[model samples]
Target chain A: MATIADVARLAGVSKSTVSRALSRPEMLLPETVATVQDAAEKLGYVANSAARFLAGGRTGVIALVVPTLDNSFFAPIIGGAQARADAEGRQVTVAVHSFAAGESLTTFGRLARQVDGFIIVAPGGSDDIVRAAATKPAVLVDREIEGMSSAVADTASAFTLVVEHFARTGRRRLVYVGGPGNSWQDAQRTAAVRAAAERVGVSLEVVGPFPPTFAAGAEAARQVRELRPDAVIPYATALGLGIQHVYLVAGETPPVVSSERAIVEALGLAGVPAIDVDGRVLGDVAARLLSQRIQDPSGDPNRVRLSVPVTWGA
Target chain B: MATIADVARLAGVSKSTVSRALSRPEMLLPETVATVQDAAEKLGYVANSAARFLAGGRTGVIALVVPTLDNSFFAPIIGGAQARADAEGRQVTVAVHSFAAGESLTTFGRLARQVDGFIIVAPGGSDDIVRAAATKPAVLVDREIEGMSSAVADTASAFTLVVEHFARTGRRRLVYVGGPGNSWQDAQRTAAVRAAAERVGVSLEVVGPFPPTFAAGAEAARQVRELRPDAVIPYATALGLGIQHVYLVAGETPPVVSSERAIVEALGLAGVPAIDVDGRVLGDVAARLLSQRIQDPSGDPNRVRLSVPVTWGA
Candidate 1:
């Protein structure tokens, strides 16, 4: 309940001096900063973030923008980002904006003025929208735009492992169940699957641009059943689980490969091969990149790609 | 990108007038408000939230504090809160704080200065810890404290349905796998199950102060197997899924009842009866209550308990 005036009065300094001592100590003498800090600690003074923003032009807050939380993929990313931000002494303000063209433009514009920078996880956003939204320092997650900092899980390379596994097992025909149309990760995954299948001389069929939900995966499974490919690869684990359910119900044991390991294990889907992409690591790396970008906005954008591991299930 | 000065210049009014018109229009004359709004619309001026906070005490932001994101139950709650906040023209800032006694005190004190109010989902927090963290207007989810606003899912009542179904099916013994030790919902569910079992003349054994995770559930299942109960009731769906996995792997069929329907279905658990509690609705109601409390901080606290439906799956 102590105010800045109380700290200033106790420390025998002006309120602005107290603010500078707490936020930007290098601008003040060490003795003055120590005196102010001693008074503030005795009074249990917690600086108001909004007032601090006005005084120092830094809110000490980071904005993490994600499209949706409906999918299981995003929760760990958020957790990772929050943990990293907490370690860096910054608060994360999560905004769930549907990045659908013009909608995110306003969200980005409004949030850009409040926080120090952004860590955006908008795989579905177009290049123009993503670029326009970067009015503040930003680090994109799972999406790469020219001259933008990004932290991507290299699932495209991992998809090659899945393809090689299928070929090694003598699976000649394969079906790849795609995810959302606008998703950059989905596009990259599709291309990787296509290129890998061609290299192995395996006949491949790419199916519908599903919405990456369990129900959509089930629908994709029906189409996949008609194709009757030797193996199936899904862009998302939720889609793979849905497809697995349909096959199990039909009394068929079709090989299904997915892009997440935790979900498959959590669901007790035994022997389901997965390309493990640690979303938490991805989020942590993105937050670190965003923090670096915030410190040096004019520095060269760093592009980090985390290697994905393949767990071929028994 | 238009500043307040630009809007004021176009509206033929002072900058203070423009700020008041955009934020607190009721303070100014109708004609003056209309002129400022029209000019602001033409210029595409977006109000800076930090500036608005300095001008008016309200930040137009709500903070949703959750214990952790490791569990699936919290995700829907967050999604629902974000959706409702968006509709009300407010942004949601999600903070994941471990409410382990003294840790959350600082988080609450710091966030209290930044956000207008809070929607806290801290089921694992002690009553004293929760009360101490509520420095701002707060709405508790799934926990009830005296003189505090709360929105709780009535899963306790739904547990009676599970007991009754087990009794009808001629099950003589039941084992209840519990969640976190400090969780009010888990305690309430335990009491309900105990009362129902006593009334139905069925023997029951209680096990675990588990973490409400898949691994913890598997451990609970091992304990329950030793007890050789005829039926099992788990406080969380994740726990139930873990128990189910153990039993399935052991080639034994055990009737497991969970507190979530979506997760059971998503995991392809057939014939698993579940008590369906809509976490999204609970979160929406909590956010709404917090918004109302922010408007009238001195108003009487509102305690809302949402009904939970039973899905007797086949």
Candidate 2:
């Protein structure tokens, strides 16, 4: 049977280099890894994954845990991570915490022993609990923890962009619908919008503690109409659509700025103008940072802060 | 730390019975299992999950692989499996196949050694690929495989209900907007709708092979209007909303039927009537079957066919 040695010989690299290329491609040059992979493929050399797992006591699997899957925000993150992991012949396992008490901790504990590392997205637990349970290589996405590597979106900038758009369009009486009270991004966006609204001298009323669902948006639309905001900024697509539905029914069309393109597209199909906070970049950046951390577990903490690019569409 | 012996003594059961209750509660009477659980809780016994994993050569983690997370259809299934697994002190890991070439097979290969069981939801690949890779205790959802356990929803009945609704309303010129061709449910739904429409003696025009996105729905809406059907049945909520959006824009409203409650609720908030096919039951049943098979891998294969319950709401 063809083996690593044959691939190393064929690729003109040492056997250890070939091993690193297979196991920790992030640590090696892309060209070198590609060459190794090509040679391995040409030789019909398939790595015995089970034998390797037995020898190293590692599962060749990494896990990404999020709070929920009902939202589209987490979909891209999973896609980016899975894409990157698949390129290196690794697999990523996703689990949801559902914000249930002791659930995240239990998941981390069980998977920490089985998988090589973990990437936790928007952990809704105390840092002490996460820190205690995460004994393996780990990275955080959309939230930051002291002494841990993380990748976060520039949410404050996203809100600033939306508020600036409202100002540019001469919109006054702006109402901000908040997301879940426990969400870090929701808190950041609320604070940013309040500051920006004050700077722009527009009347801003922030209302919610909404759970970021379509139903929540439907319920919040009544309050939005009462406030009589000319412009509405909702933290989720479902909420944005709900508010838009309200205006459409009332025969009064108002601008609704959303944080996702999907919401904009859905409303735009009905000729409603909206702004989107580009979240697609979050997943790709988080995946890169996570892969780097996983390849070299003892490396210095690396923080990636991605700016939110705003797009106005009709 | 409390041990199994202490719990067994307190619960007045043998050690083997206590172990069976913990691992495979389906094998024991519900009352006896409840008694054992109560005793364990009273005694403050925390199972050493990691030690048990090492001793049994099992990871204490089950895996669920889906085609994509872009749609909300799979959310309930995930929640059901995760909730059940959590109750038994087990973790459910999720992975996406993305329907790429050999993707499901590769995922199954990588995760097979790391997890004790698997529940693959709506596999997009050939059945042979799935049957080949699934050597561990496994259950299928939304699709069936010969010689394997499966849980499938009754798509035929759902279409019959929608067709009957159309017939009852005396609506003619029915248009059916279809989902992706490769989607098993989409194919099943399309065939069922065609058969039912014929039985109802309605003229049916099926359009699509669309990607089931808002944009695709928007595009399909243009075609739908040209067809000028009195009622339209979209295979998915996105398409139905798209069709509805077109009508609302043209200032000519037509009745649209959707298969999800969320879509119905969103549009119903605008006073539109719609039908919902509950997918919430898929996950719970699949989870239960998977758990049973995992506990008794040598048991007879079980097939569960869930009837679709349709609800019409404003």
Candidate 3:
């Protein structure tokens, strides 16, 4: 129940001075800022974030919006964003939004009014939705919008390495299991893999627009069994795990490659080839981009693409 | 840029009526609420949550606080909490806090002013930290504090089943690997296993206050190898995965029992005995309890302990 007036009186400053000290300390002397902070802490005078937002002041909070947490892929991303945000002296509020077509615009609008800006990880989101949601400063992860900033993993390039490895290992027939049909990353990977397979003169087939889940992977594995490809490339780690489980149960060991090294190692898939995609690094890059975007909204939007390393396992 | 006054004029209602229609629709007639909603939507009117909080109204937002997202165990819990919050017409904001001794109090103090309540999952937190953080309505997960609502899994009793199974299977020596040192759940599990072993006259040894991670499990595995127990009970699935990997690499298949079925199944540990602990259900229960607490802060606190089913695997 401590008031701003009490803090001002205790710190021997005017009301406007107190407000400025709390909201825009960079504009004031460090000693004055320290005095105001000490007084506020002594009296337990927490500034009302809602009032600050109404006054056009920063909330010092960032929103990290993801499609869902069911996929283990997003967990490290969240952790990385949270850690980077903490380092920048900002708090992260994670919002799980499916980004379903009709509801996303409204969700974005409401969320935009609450946080300073956003770090959005919506791989399957359409460009139209991105345009609508871009009303606020946002950095897209694993996807690119025409005029927005993005942090993307070079999975497309990594797929080329996978294809070359398959070809070198005498895996003539190759099948690529795709994830979430609308995913921008999936489209890029598919295109890259197709081009690489054509260059290598290997027979290639594409199957599934399945969800990036273990259960869905099992279903994809069944259809894949009939196709009988010598090498398999799954778009997500969960899909690779599912495919591997089904094959192992049937006592078959078709060559499988994944782009997630952490999950592969944890699951004891030492013999499987994997491309290292550090989600934490991807998250850190996206958050840094978002922080820069928030500070300079009119700056030319930058795109950062990180390299993926492939490990040919034993 | 639509205002409440604009929506009120369009709907032919007072500004106060417009506010009530949006915030407390249950108090108004259904048709009146519909008219106000339609008018607001047509005008693109989004209420400022900060302004609502200034006026002493509910924010309709909940915070789900977890220690960290490094462990895959918390992902499903977050998903379930978000699902339930969406059903209740509330938004979920996830906060990651380490619950370190001195810092958690301040963190909780700031977060308390922003959200309506909290769903806290801090297994390694101390009683003092929980007490200090309980300034707002909070429901504990996997830990019990007196005079507070909690949703806990009965892992203690489940450990008894694990011990009984070890006895029935003619495993004379048992090793129990514990999780975080300060975790209440770990204490409960260790005590239960010790009692059951005593009753069955089986030689038992306790090891590790290790972190609930795969790498830590590998470290614990080294020590367990020295102990040479016939059966191993790891406090977490990640630990079980790590221990299993190390043992399998060395061409040993010691019986490992875990209390997390999802991760075990996903990792293809079909032959490992697992006690089913549905994290989604735990999250749903905790969110439901927190929602109730928010509505009735003066009500008696409730504790709900969910039963864990043991799967004696092949």
Best candidate per TM-score, number? 1
- In CAPRI terms, where does candidate 3 land? acceptable
lDDT of 2 by residue, B21-49 (tens): 76566678878877887787687554345
- Native-referenced DockQ of model 3: 0.32
lDDT tens digits, residue span B96-186, model 3: 8868775524445555656789999988767877767877789999999999999999989999988988788788989999998988999
**lDDT against the true structure, each candidate:** 0.78, 0.71, 0.78
Query: Per-residue CA lDDT of candidate 2, range A1-314, in tens?
Result: 56779989999999999877766666788788778877866885543443354345566667777887677667777777776776565666676764445552433444464567777886366677666756788788887778888888787787787888888788888989999876777878889999999998998999998877656776788888899887888887667766665565566664644545554564453423344433445655666776787678789988888876666764
What is the CAPRI rating of model 1's predicted complex?
acceptable
Candidate 3 chain B, run of 10 with poorest lDDT: B102-111
**Native-to-model Cα distance after best TM-score fit, residue A216 in candidate 2, in Å:** 2.5
Query: How does candidate 1 score on lDDT?
Result: 0.78
* Candidate 1 lDDT over residue span B94-185, tens digit each: 88876886562543554665678889888876788888888789999988999899999998999988887888888888999988997889
Per-residue lDDT of candidate 3, residues A196-231 (tens digit): 999999998999898886656767888888888888
Clashing pairs in 1: none
Higher-scoring candidate on lDDT, 1 or 2: 1
State chain A's TM-score for model 1. Answer: 0.84
Comparing 1 with 3 on DockQ, the higher-scoring candidate is 1
What lDDT does candidate 1 reach at residue A270? 57
